[model samples]
Target: MAKRSNGEGSVRRRPNGTWEARLYYEDPRTGVRKRRSFYGQTAAEARRQMREARERLAAGAPVADSVMTMQEWCWRWLETTVAASSRRPATRVLYESLVRSHLSLPPLGQMMLGRVRPSDIEALVLRLRARGLAESTVQRIFIVLRMALEGAVRDGLIARNPAALVRPPRIERTEARHLSVEEVSALLECARGTRYYSLLRLIATTGLRKGEALALTWDAVDLDRGELQVRATLTRIEGELVVSAPKTAQSRRVLPLAPAEVEMLAAHREQQAVELSRVGEWQQDGFVFTTETGEPMDPRNVLRAMTTAAANAGLSDVNVHTLRHSAATAWLEAGVNVKAVSALLGHADIRITADVYGHVSEAVSRAAMVGLSDSLREPPRD
Candidate 1:
């Protein structure tokens, strides 16, 4: 039997008793012939959809005829979109690593890009959680997946983004531990004469992130004005250290230094000058913090020094970042405004400061309650 050939489309009954109308057209982008099938419960409905599809294709509009797989689209997005994007090098590296290490796998990676549904992504999240992955890691994976799918949507490979329909797992917030005034004093004392003494004290006093402090140069600091400028941060990428702009615009800030910190920095500078003179040559980069060889100290070395000092001071569970948390908590307890503290910490939002240190300062909360009780007390009639 000869099959009926329609100029526009062909209608046939599928095995499941449904009608399918397939329209053949040439893709405007690739100039290649492609076929798109429209299914319906009835032949009339199928024909109607096929007519619409034909009209769209004739008008140079794209039809859903892509056979690109998820793996293919993901790689394209990574190489063309993510790689060519204006994202920071560190961020690009992180996204690339996440896609290569986690997203490229069987069952999900090999699936058709257009066929990925919310259930498929949710299943991936569940599987990651079952493998004891952290909520933040799971969320990062989902973020990369969503961004890739967003690119596919932009390119008309899929009508809608399935990742947008599914919710990533919520990250659990952990309270940061801060040291007490006495404990801070003891720790700084134990760190006295050590290479990390000034670095630890600077972080404790100004709340500068370890990377930011390590990346600082003498040019960014105005010792006479007692101000320290934060413009860039040092981060390790692919086992190599790189200095880049702060994470956000708000992170670039000028922080005031305490008088004692200024004096300490002045002395440290003089000491560095002597060390450089003895070495018979000056280091080109005038970074405030460096090794005896006048080279930038590795952040890991600073952390190890801090940890050893903390152990000597009888402090438990204290790391390099504890100094930063301690500063914020102390400022809040001292009745400093949250917004001021937020700006001092180089936080992009005041709400982040509130969320992190607002309720965690039990001493401040207790003082507030005591003051409220005092105000509510009734005066005795004389």
Candidate 2:
């Protein structure tokens, strides 16, 4: 008998000149003790396998066998680690989409859990790019694969994460499009007398994200204080509308209400009240924006409303985000402090504000230069 000093595992000669190695451990997940065995033709080979298992166990890693396929491990990881965790449903939905559409396919998926090599991971990236997938999408797919393999490492299924050794595709950042103040005002006016008028106007005035605006509740608004708090966001998760906390801590914030928005909201509230009165108990509450039936506004309908208004206003390619950017652009161009604008937009960092509205800053600088030159010019009478 060749026994480990810790008495956790042993290698022994078996019947008919073969060798068997055994490691005993407690299953943390199941809370039960279990035994795992390995076999080899030579005692030395059996001992080596036994030693690897013991080392993994000593390192606080699970001693599970790596016989599962990559596809199997990925699903297990999704169901147990991602879905079962405390992550938002939207995050889980994204992970699910990525795993199903990319990780659980073809040669990589069918391979053994520990069989993936760095080269195989690199080839997957190349194949995805060959299919003409956007670099961002390809980068996202690679991240899902990497996350799956990292789970495998934790479960003792693989010693190294091959995806970690591969480089992901680089993503190019495109400049965000936004409307000018005049265009935004025209869009708002076009949407006026329509149900989405107030919502669109609010976004342009406050730079609130569509989700954050839709998620706004009566409790979060203070008409007297002329303020509103962004506490949650309403988004679709797996096709079901869900109200969840803001995506980032900075996203949960308080914003001052411009006088125009305050008046707009007051009128909107009155209109909403009249509409809800007719709903006859089918009415839902706690949402600032709602459907005719008083339910939370479906995100799709919100888009339709916005697009219709944009088309009528002769604004092409305007989306919900355009309004937010338009508001930020207006703030930057009007000489508001960049930091103040960033806080108003609930940005995690001021740099993000500067990046998106960098053009606005340049324009502001040029205007200031003109003003300075004019003021410093010699008087004509001199």
Candidate 3:
């Protein structure tokens, strides 16, 4: 499909330090002439905005102008930009969820984009806070709204992002939760007969992200060398499982495994073989972990197993992530360098490791004191 040729758009600088680009087009279906406008902070931005709109028209997606309602703009932006971008599947899902649950509400849903004000966005934030939404959730809603309107600016649909002008709610600080060593053992014991037993054990010991563990394949494991590589992640998009590259370059790393974990994994492979042989329709997917018929494991199934195990063990608020944090905390408490811990966990930045695991555990505190005393020891010759 080709974009119908549009009239040459005009760009002009406004008196208020903003730029405007305008074009006139005839609606093909209605045979009515209409004016479309785009805006930016500079003449070049305005022109680029206009050009992108034309490209979208060429691709057969109509650009909703400023006259359209906020709801219409949200829907259009989601389909034309967010859903179509190169962003992660997780991110796309988050944006879509926020739009449906919050942005589509009455406050701004029916209001025209041209008439939206900073005050309107502020009201939405206040409303979300008043309704007892978590500070994190309220912050996320505001972020998505800002991003959606920024998409509007890029598409030349809105002159500015009002949400940008409005102050977003402050996000409360939080630390990752970790389980005690005894709690970890009890949970594993409870999960011993379950499908995710080995998986939970692997993550608790190795701190592997749930997605990374679910996507693991036999080829990535080196039992003899006592190492494994994180090469892919598993995610569900629109109800279908998809395997994709690691979220960051650092996420694709080789990690050393303990001898016990290696032995456990070897045993797991033997058991898996026995289980697969009993199923006549094995898919031979080669995943290190799989369903009984050899299909890739679903993350939801893993979560279910963890929830059941936690309940049985009398552990509260425990999930796959709790196991990961526990492993990191264990490593740090063992006097491992923060830098080494950062690499072991495939953290993109060392600061992320420091921030999440910065809280001092009793073991870490004692180790620190012992190390300090040794460094301050008197010279024997004196």
lDDT of each residue in 241-353, candidate 1, tens digit only = 78889998889999999899999999999988889888865557878898887777788899899888899999989998999999999898898989999999999888888
**Per-candidate RMSD vs. true structure?**
4.2, 4.2, 8.5
lDDT score of model 1? 0.86
Q: What TM-score would you give candidate 1 relative to the actual structure?
A: 0.88
In candidate 1, which residue ranges exceed 4 Å CA deviation?
A: 1-20, 24-62, 280-282
RMSD of 3: 8.5
User: Considering lDDT, which of the candidate structures 1 and 2 is the better prediction for this target?
Assistant: 1
**TM-score, ranked from best to worst:** 1, 2, 3
Please report the TM-score between candidate 3 and the true structure.
Answer: 0.79
Better of 1 and 2 by TM-score: 1
Using lDDT as the yardstick, the better of models 2 and 3 is 3
CA error at residue 254 for candidate 2, angstroms: 0.7
Tens-place lDDT digits, model 3, residues 1-382: 5554565578889999899999766654466767788999999998998888766555544545468888888988889888778888877788888889889878698899878899999888889889999999999888888988888777666656788888778974567899889899999999998789999999999999999999999999999999999999998988999888888899999988899999999999999999987888897778998998888899998999999999999999888889999999888877799999999899999999998998878776888899899999999994
Q: List the residue pairs that clash in candidate 2.
A: none
Query: TM-score of the candidate numbered 2?
Result: 0.83
Q: Which parts of model 3 have CA positions greater than 4 angstroms off? A: 1-65, 377-382
